[model samples]
Target: MSAGETVHLTLDEVRALAKAGLAKTGLSPDHVDAVAETMVSGERDGCASHGIYRLLVAASSVKSGVVVPDAVPELSEPSPALVRVDGKGGFAQLPFRLGAPLLAEKARKFGIAAMGLNNVVHFAALWPEVEELTRQGLVALAVTPSHAWVAPAGGTKPVFGTNPIAFGWPRSSGEPFIFDFATSAVARGEIELHRRAGKPVPDDWGYNADGHATTVAEEVLSGAMRTFGGHKGSALAAMVELLGGPLIGDMTSLQSIEADGGRGGSPIGGEFIIAIDPAGFVGDLLAEYMKHAEVMFETITGQGARLPSQRRYEARKKSLVQGVEIPAALMRDIEKLLEES
Candidate 1:
């Protein structure tokens, strides 16, 4: 879609849409606001696949009794530096809101704090959580498991999740240096985007149901997404699934059978967040860290490498200056849904 053809929705308008959608599911204003804020943040950051497009899915899951809006996270303080929260099949944003502050508090006291969350719905974007921790002068690392979308090394079957991992570090320049990415060759969302656009996937990105590599998006959707770097990516995906899926006694990709039955089962995924207080390790280390990071980043740029988070960061700046861009088709769909509501 051409950027010039995009529509700009104000934050208020986005919130209103989310509120109306959530209300249709019998959610209270407070929960609606929470979901809306997360959705708008994703949109503002230019993650369109995880932004407004997923709102319909979320609302539908709630209305279908797949997700419980009133479900409270069961919090457990297993250690001074760790917390485990069972999301009780509620919206993902709830555990994020509850865990972030607690982790920040614990990080302030200890050198680091880690939290494990389970049984939540999809967490749209990882940047917002990292942004929150960065604002608290802490570095945050987050990892989450997903449905089987990627194949293991030398294997044809879809056996692993996209399993994204994200990291955020505070900078002396006031803007956090954040990196968030999927272990797969491309995000599953990107594949979905191509499917929606009726485009083909890159041949290097995924394999067909018969385990042959192809550039057809439909084949990838019906088959398996490739890991980013072959065996290395497959290994990392496995590690992520271990840390972010079953390590905390949560379900894995193979364990998620509810979706097959047309019931909103817990996606049975897990997420882990670790917040670290830089000051605890080295006072004024933020400055030193930025210095090294800058040098490394400049070297990469000189070698024709772009930083991981630079694109989204630049997109966010432009959005703030010139309004966020929403595809005309998406806007039309959103408008139609709004009218229906």
Candidate 2:
């Protein structure tokens, strides 16, 4: 198929493609499964940026020897309200898996808890992290820093990562309420996608190395990406950098990129995840409060205001029945990676 053509794939096909490609990249069997599941979920939820396309970036880290293929994630309880995991140079998924249960337990016992995942290569979307906690009837928040590619407000220097934050609130029934977004004007992958498609990005997306506004994606990549909402977004990005980096005893965006040694791979650093139990706060009134929450949601939807995760949930339903479609160019690329490796 040509680069412009598209390939339709079932959820199973997406999983198979992700697993096969990741396996060829020297990620261990378990890690491949963990990461592939993320890709499948991304595709199933219509997040093209986080789907099978993510293999290119993940493989870059593995191929460069930045990610230790066989690293084992080790977990420890740092405090009654905090858990920590050392990823030992592997992907973030396994570390999170190892720590999630402990996080939930601590949250249940202490009302709130935090988990720090360190020395991990972060690639997947944060919603999955928070969504998992919400599934256990807990509110969750997650944040992580990417490489130092974005500039703070009104500044030319690339001092901030395209830091993303996600929050999840459990509902009485069906899907939870969730929102995940990058502080950058657009995700780095979005810019990369524009570059690969030979398309110009929006003027506000980035600036040249000299900091002049430009519509060219490649220049923005080598130069400075803009943050959304100017100062407000910059501040949030800084918060993510701080909370996910120094707060967790890991590298900041600048430090993360420096550690990259010029490898165009995923960031190597930490993630901050918080879980809070509503039961702890409301007690037996949990049911009443949950109904109250539903009223708020209904009021919003009743006025035609959509919840942030509505589109994703809708796509998920459709994909479960109809599957997903991927660009043929990306498909061929993955196929080649699997073949050559």
TM-score of every prediction relative to native: 0.88, 0.95
Candidate 1: tens digits of C-alpha lDDT, residues 104-153: 88998998999888888764777788888898889899888778778998
- Candidate 2 lDDT, 136-173, residue by residue in tens: 98999999998999999979779889899999999968
lDDT of 1 at 341: 45
> Each model's C-alpha lDDT?
0.77, 0.92
Judge candidate 2 against the unseen true structure and give its global Cα lDDT, from 0 to 1: 0.92
C-alpha displacement of 159 in model 2, angstroms? 1.0
- Candidate 1 error regions (>4 Å): 1-5, 196-198, 257-266, 284-290, 298-305, 339-341
Residue 93 accuracy (lDDT) in model 1: 75
lDDT of 2 at 109: 96
Shift of residue 267 alpha carbon in model 2, Å: 0.6
